[model samples]
Target: MSRGAWRDRGAWLLAFMHAFVAVCVLLPSAGVHAAETVHAQIAATSEQVAALTAVLEARLEPLVLEVTAVEAVDPAAALSAPPTEDVARVWITLDDGGATAIVLSGDGARGMVRQLPREGASDEVLREELALVIGTAVDTLRRDAASLASSAALREELGLSPEPEPPPEPAPSVEPPPPAPPEPSPIASLPPLPPVVRTPPPVEPTRWRLAGMAFYEVQGFAAGQIIAHGPGLSLGLGGPPLTLGPRFELSGQYRLPAAAENDVAGLRLHSGAFRLTTQLTVVRSSRVLLRVLGGAGLDLLVIEPFLVDARAELMPRRVRIAPALRFGLDVPVRLAGEVSLRIGAGMDVDAIGTRYVIQDGDALVPLLDPLRIRPLLSLGVDTTFVGHPAFGP
Candidate 1:
């Protein structure tokens, strides 16, 4: 309410406004000075540029260094430009010989040239080496700038005149030394060593092979008009093939009994066989094998009759054995590892013929006629193992 009090309030407000305006104007300039910037100009292939930039950034991450990629018409001109206090410029160039890196800071320009390794090296390795060189140069520039700042501050504190120092003259480029000549052989003056004796590798002795197979077989008896099919197992032992002779295998097979029935008389015919065979390998390769087989065996046949008519009299079951001769061709294809799929077709000739019949009242109805020839088909898996002879070296 008093005049002196109002005048005092106005003066205080004016002073506060002037201070706020000063702070607003100076704060941004201080922030801009505090933040340092690094610009990188790469003059190399695209692959080199990408590799160098990524590795350089990773190496400088601990320093919170920010790298900005820039394109320059002349990298030399960029490197030679006047340096700023808060900014650094790096120029990297790749050539056939190696890489060259130049860094410019407040202190001046620093450069490094690295030669490629004499031995052939990959582009990735070369990029890493060049990136390391550039990183070292940048670190040196930072140290020099920090040292100059400290020296200037110390001089101002001592109240001495802050005199500017001229930039140091650039050092003359030095060429890399030429490669040294190869050393002379120590044994050059001595008589030539005895001709190196080379021995031939020993030949591997032949080994016997044991083979086994489990199969499902189908046999058609055309003469008797019956089909019999069942599972069979076989085992064989064979020697390796000779240069001019076929490989031989002696095998034995036993087929389980399988049955076929006649619809009219309800007569069931069951048959099985046991055979001894000798197989000769005609063609054998890694992928496929062919063999011709011949053998002799015994065939067993059984017959049973069931009649539905009340007056029909069924004959008792009968079993018969007949000698047989077998001839076949087998082909085995390798599936994987030591396993093979075997397929065979064969024929059997019976030595004796026997007939089967059923009795109904006064009628004698034939069930199966004598079987003279039977054709056979088979599919199986085969495996073999090789072993050295028991008594031979």
Candidate 2:
């Protein structure tokens, strides 16, 4: 078979095997992982939203009551006073713009109030408006009992019926039986009540953290290509704004390639390269992460082409581009106070160099095509130096 045909067949076989293994095995596991990841993120988001909404609701409760008819009935009483046995229910509604009038009626009382939200102000304004609306009605009732009576009369005139009164209790019968004798003394009565137990207040969790990482790499190219070995470094940032997870990262690495030759085919010389990488971690847990990284840097290549006889072609250094891909675990170490470490493994791809001369005739002929690909394996570690403290017990 021609050389091109043989290369294409080998490539197809490799691709098919990779597909088979991935579809039958890796894909199923990955699908489960994806589902779990989505569930976790949704759960975390829901928890945060719930907590925030609770706080807002609690703060707004007093304000809502203050502006409604419930407070107009008795606004002078201290907030700490025991609630009256006769409860009055009131419901209030506000427009989206926060500018509107509301009418509330319950317990034979009815009132209306206007509400407004000031620009560049907090919800405190809402509370203020609520007080003003309810306070006006209370003042009107206190200053002039006649006005209150008049309002009640006006309601009656409008055919508004008063609330119904509760039924009266029945009188007791005559000629009752004699009372029974007392049975127990204080000492013989029920056992003394157990001492009231007290519980300590709950502690809040720590909510800050930082992470760091480093790695080592080994790479080899296809036949007639070069091989390289090197180390890489990475720094990561994480915290509450990023939803209490690690995301931002910066990394750099250097690699050295080895040279070799085949007797039947030709000679090859490897080159050295340097690369810088950056990644954003989309999702992360204590030990694992789903990340996406991309970066471009410089690479240096040294060439040694093969000749027909015994001599070979040599060329000067050339500059090229380098790119990488990463996927791995970031384990933590807690040897130092509030400090941690990370270790990981991933794959990388880079452009080695180009080809120019080939052994053809008396003089070396120029070979136009020169693109090359390299496959790499890497290991890394990181230390948290300037990061926030992660949440813990």
Candidate 3:
């Protein structure tokens, strides 16, 4: 296009743009004015309602109001017009029985009971309710006063009653139990005797005893040439006492040898014996006693040789007897405790030859010379099921 024509069109477009800007700016101011006018109207209505509410309240109870104003810079100041208003309302209903009072403002939209009526059904009903409440209060007060009066009367009566007398206690008395019959002495009941009581008089107590021992021995002339004399268990018994008021007892004992003799080279001598004994119990107490024992017995000895070549042989299966003596103490910790432990030591004097003899190499030799006089010591625990209180009557 030509420059002149283009310039003319540009100018026309500029003019139209300026007109649009002007319209946009003016339209906002118009709308703001309209909104401010509406708000002012709302404010006026709120004030009128508040005023009317105050009037209703005053009629119900008394009230008052004061108003004042000030000025400030505002764009709406130029557009300000006279204050516009409309009336606001409130309603109240009061019923005393059925005839409700109807005091109201001119529009019937607002009112109050500034004053109540005198005497109708509603008035009488209200008075009656009030009377009923008052009567209940008066009745409660009368009951409280009557209770106080009754308490005072009770106090006066109690003060007039006589006091009671105290009770008396009885005296104690003494009485003796009837005398028991006397028991007759045993001698009074016996017939005339001829010097002695005979029938062996009476035995004070029965007696019992035990005797035994154990031994281990190895004999050899040099090292690695020893033999085991196998271990043995033996026991002896003493019977009841004899004449002279418990002087003697009959006793016996037996022993057996064990099977394994550790000796690997020479003869292993294992011995067993039995003896008959007599004992005397020396009376010590109703439940305790001491005793001395004497006895004689027989024994059997077996000699076995287990050679280094694994061969074994048995020699002289012999029988023999010997005598022994025993002395010991018996202690009873408690008469009826059911348990007792006795400890004793004694000696056995054996006449060596009667037992066994062997041919060692060339000459005859006593196999077990019986040790002549061997000492015996032992401890034993015994239970007397018959004598203990738990077992006795």
Candidate 4:
């Protein structure tokens, strides 16, 4: 046996044994003597597909490769350009007896079906055989992904549907009638009640959103003074943009200056935090979206002192990490294309000791104290993606 085959023997044996049990459970016997050949062929095809999928995902990414059911695929999909498209099509088939075929007709390669060893073949043997079978097709897919990483393509390629065209604007809202005058006679009348107006519910937003922002430190209780502004960003990475669904988010903020109170330590502070959060859609409608979110992650603070003694030496540059919890709102209004205007807010609290830093000559000393919760306010632009792969050209 070759070195490559020998190396894969253990993993192949283990996977093959598991595959055998799965195949047996899925493919019942017609008779005690012999199992159906087509069932075995189906099992064979499944194993090969699984192998291909594993390799591709490890080398490329889930966004770069998509697995689909035969029925879900359109007959015309073969004509779409994979390099510029979200998905590519290739075929794998197993024959009734001792043969298998790999068809690379659609994804920018020659339209030919190549044969390989039959089902139940050992992994050691199949590895060598299958490499020759699908190697070129894998290469083609890798090239396509690399070429289109940063292209201005629509998000529909990743199985996402385009947003429907917007409806025409609604008629202007009518004002409620004014309240009637109070009774002139000696009596029975308190001040007339004002007319009531019912407001519309918040709208839900469809599609993934990406945003970059600048923060205004509305309140920083621990620092005792208003923190100077900072920079932040958010990503709507939850699975899909469906209604009332829970979505995952990865977000971050960096406040460049969290100036210490009273300058007691002759030191100032800089803080940054990273979080993974979930946002649940409360409403989505024409031109508006509302979501409520909560998240927890790492908060980092750096203490730097003002060193101004000719050489201006400040000692003991210190840093600390705290557990942070955040809850917030993300409301965005639709603009042209995939862009939106965002007005968002959050409450962030960190569990950290507010250690005071003071200068004793060139050495900096510290005294431990408690910290407080911070409120963050931001205004920024957000954009929806057509399944932007995490890594792109």
Q: List the residue pairs that clash in candidate 3.
A: 249-278, 249-279, 251-277, 275-297, 277-295, 298-321
Model 4 segments more than 4 A misplaced: 1-224, 261-264, 307-315, 357-371, 387-393
Report the backbone clash tally of model 4.
10
What's model 4's lDDT at 383?
68
RMSD of 4: 46.9
Model 1 residue 167 distance off true place after TM-score fit, in angstroms: 99
Stronger candidate by TM-score (2 vs 3): 2
- Name the 10 consecutive residues with the lowest summed lDDT in model 1: 242-251
State the lDDT of candidate 3 residue by residue for 97-167, as single tens digits. 22111121112222221222435644334434333332332233323433222322322433433323457
User: What are the per-model C-alpha RMSD values against the true structure?
Assistant: 32.0, 50.6, 37.0, 46.9
**Which lDDT value does model 3 have at 194?**
78
Instruction: For residues 1-393, write the lDDT of model 2, one tens digit per residue.
Output: 899999999999999999998799977765544331110000113333344334433533322222212212222121112322111222232223443323222222443334455455554454456435544544443344334333244345434554345588776768778888887787876889899999988855334435666677666544445456677676666655335353556665565545444442343444444544454556545444445555555555445444444554444444444443334333444445544444444444434444445554576554433334444555554555654444232
Candidate 1 root-mean-square deviation in Å:
32.0
Against the unseen true structure, what C-alpha lDDT does each candidate score? 0.66, 0.45, 0.37, 0.54
TM per candidate? 0.43, 0.34, 0.30, 0.39
Candidate 3 deviant stretches above 4 angstroms = 1-265, 286-288, 306-336, 352-361, 364-369, 385-393
User: Which residue pairs collide, candidate 4?
Assistant: 149-393, 155-386, 203-283, 203-284, 203-285, 204-283, 204-284, 204-285, 238-248, 265-357
Q: What is the alpha-carbon lDDT of model 2 when measured against the actual structure?
A: 0.45
Worst 10 residues of 3 by lDDT: 35-44
- Cα error, candidate 1, residue 41 (Å): 99
Give the Å shift of residue 319 in candidate 1.
2.8
